[model samples]
Target chain A: MDDEVIICRCEEVTKGEILKAIEQGAKTITGIKIRTRAGMGLCQGRTCGRLIARLLAERTAQVLEEIPPATVRPPVRATKMENLVTSHGE
Target chain B: MVNKADAVVIGGGVIGNSIAYYLAKYGVDTLLIERKDLAAGTSGACDGFIFLQSKKPGFDLRLALESTRLYENLADELSYDIEYRKCGGMILIETEEQLKAIIELVDGQRKTGLDVKLMRIPQELEPILSGHIIGATHSPLDAQVNPFKVVLGFAQGAKRKGAQILTHMEVQAIRTRTVRGELKVDSVITERGEIKTNTVINAAGVHAPVIAKMVGLDLPIIPRRGQVLVTEPLPDLVTSLLVDAEYITLKLAPDHRGTDGLGLGFTLEQTASGNLLIGSTREFVGYDRRTTYHGIKAITQNVLRIAPALKEVNIIRSFAGLRPYTPDGLPILGKLRGVEGFIVAAGHEGDGIALAPITGKLIAELVVKGKPSISLDEFGLERFK
Candidate 1:
């Protein structure tokens, strides 16, 4: 696969990286956002969400818009996952 | 007996409120109804850019020009502050092809008596922009306003003039009655109850089709979703509205760039509160109002290209709104052929905020006087047939 096909514009993650992540069982956009940090930038994946959705659809052979949009958590920017997990657990 | 009025304007967005305001001013008792809070639809969520630069070279341009002129004095006429700023707009051209297109656009604009000029390395284009650009076209008559304030002002003004504006009043169906040989709209059944009236105006924005269907009329209006983002206030990086011609082909103008279905794009603008409005994405994904990562990146990347200095600005929030799009990109206004007393003022699409005041005035004229001051032949509902 061509590296020029950028799957995630936020982390500059290429299609190859997403495909590799998928192979490692990173199925959802949130999962990919956590693992590869593909959408964990200033925009929080507003730019890369649709592209990731399309890539997911093409790879999985599903309709594009039918794929549920990424869950938009408040403070829309990137947050420390550890902090969230610890706060919830406490 | 149920409460009644001469006319009921459905959908309490800018269009509905403006229509109700004008109607009441004309001494025609009116009622304005909204399913949610006023301006809850595209009216509240959009950057109120009253622009003429991006309009297609013919009839649409004329509509924009007329609306732009009306917006110039709307704040004063309504005796309310709508933050109407006649700040010029620039369409940055990155390639020779785009420059050619800009030239054509300028030619059309000049023919229509618009104050437009193609700027090649303009000196006035300063601190507002922080990137390399090949060329740009400037239109001095373009302006911006706070959509929320404008809608509120219209609604308040309408209420002050005897129009009963009711929020959270959803119209369930339209009740028809025969007067002599002619069929007329008698009342509107709401979720709560019914309000009897002689006339009904459909300004339901994205839900215009649904409301029209209640009266057995087919209104071919589809929801075109546009997502917008807001950045924390910076020192006025973008003074005048800036756009990219190539981005226009992608429908990714600077104000509403990211969330539309178009690939990585951004439109940047500065509000009176000093916050930067960055946007957006345009997609034809039915009524889904979800924002995607691709939409955000598209806007961010485009914003960076236009103003690299904005890299440090933190985006505070992001949102999506749907524009009621017609197939030919023109609005469906005026009364339906077979449906008596049922008029449509929806499908202004992305231009709704800009076109609201004029559309209201026109609808008021059509309803009260049986014809409009301007030609409504092109905007008639019969075009769908």
Candidate 2:
């Protein structure tokens, strides 16, 4: 597998970054987030959610279900400044 | 590029942005730096709760009161709409134990001159609230704001006042020097370059302790992870910031575990766009900011305890933030000994949005004028040592 393969496009996180995070004791998806910031982007982790999880699972020799997904936050999609600034604008 | 500033504030969340805004407003050459965009971390992840009712009755509540006062006209003053709302709050009492705690909580707040009512909440306030709740404590003073806008507004306002906000400029290290038998922060080394500043304010949120480490002062601030789920924008289900008594107790008391074994507390809020923002947990999982299946499941089931109609609601997103947890549950403010020109303004775990305004004003006052408008004696770093 190419280490350069992009995992989290929102943050430009790559498989190399994910692998490095895993090597640094990132046993969980949340752990990976803290280390590489893979899921802390615009889409919040929806796009790269499974790719990072599967990579973590493969490395740890654990089932995919064992590795949890990263936390998804508000404005699940790209939001305009107006929607974010004003209450009723959304 | 090399830049010199009178004060350099690290972190781009509400706290740092507020400090930058205040410092710039005070005519100080300030530089606000962030590793990510504004409100990208906990400020963006958590709900926009400018809550005062849940504050601990003494200095904490006083701080909330003062901050709320600052927020009253923040949108007008900033010339940017932050979506500030005093939509009120209702803390649900489920168990008899919760009832007693809330009674004491409200009594303490009332003694502090906060207008709060302890009774069966009228159906007009929140008809969707579960009938199973024994009672609720309602406070009109409770308010909220768009955390993102608050950060953005402060950033733009601060920029307009000539504060340089450098996003993606990560602080690599803290450069310090000894002059006249005193250790002082000489300059802040960042990924971009060096920022020579006499004063450095650590408003770095959950990453605060890591910043404190550079100065050799061990702050006992730990990052406590909290998760929240966002439901599709629905009709006005609840008008108030609805939370549980267990949530309040767990947040106020660190030693106490969940009233229920699941360790999940319900916080339901209806955003201006009509989305049901439900949250959260106080898991001590270090700096891992990911949403877990168990965490989401717990929040969903618990919120259902308050509003059964939510069982069918589709969750659009799930996210988490790392709360800057201190041992005593109080935020660390003011300067530390041995590190002159290094001020500590972080450790606001869950109440960062609520306390940002006051923190900014007090810290800025302490920096520029050498005396804060309010006494910060109790919140100083000496108590932690």
User: Which candidate has the top score in lDDT?
Assistant: 2
RMSD of 2: 9.9
Each model's DockQ score: 0.03, 0.07
Write one digit per residue (lDDT tens) for candidate 1, span A1-90: 585687676457888888775554444675455345576555768988887787778786768878777667444564332222223311
lDDT of 1 by residue, B1-385 (tens): 2478899999988889889988998989998888866766788667867777777776678888888888888888788888889988888877788888778878987887788998887436745455467778888888899887788778778878988877756788899987787778988998778888878999999999999999898888898877776665556556677777754655423233334336333455688767677766667788877665556556666776677766666765567888888876778999887768999999988888888888988899998999989877898777767
CA shift of B17, model 2, Å: 0.3
Model 2, range B187-234, lDDT digits (tens) per residue? 999877888999999999888888988999888888888888776667
lDDT of every predicted structure (CA atoms): 0.75, 0.82
Give candidate 2's TM-score: 0.82
Stretches of candidate 1 off by over 4 Å are A1-90, B128-131, B179-182, B250-266
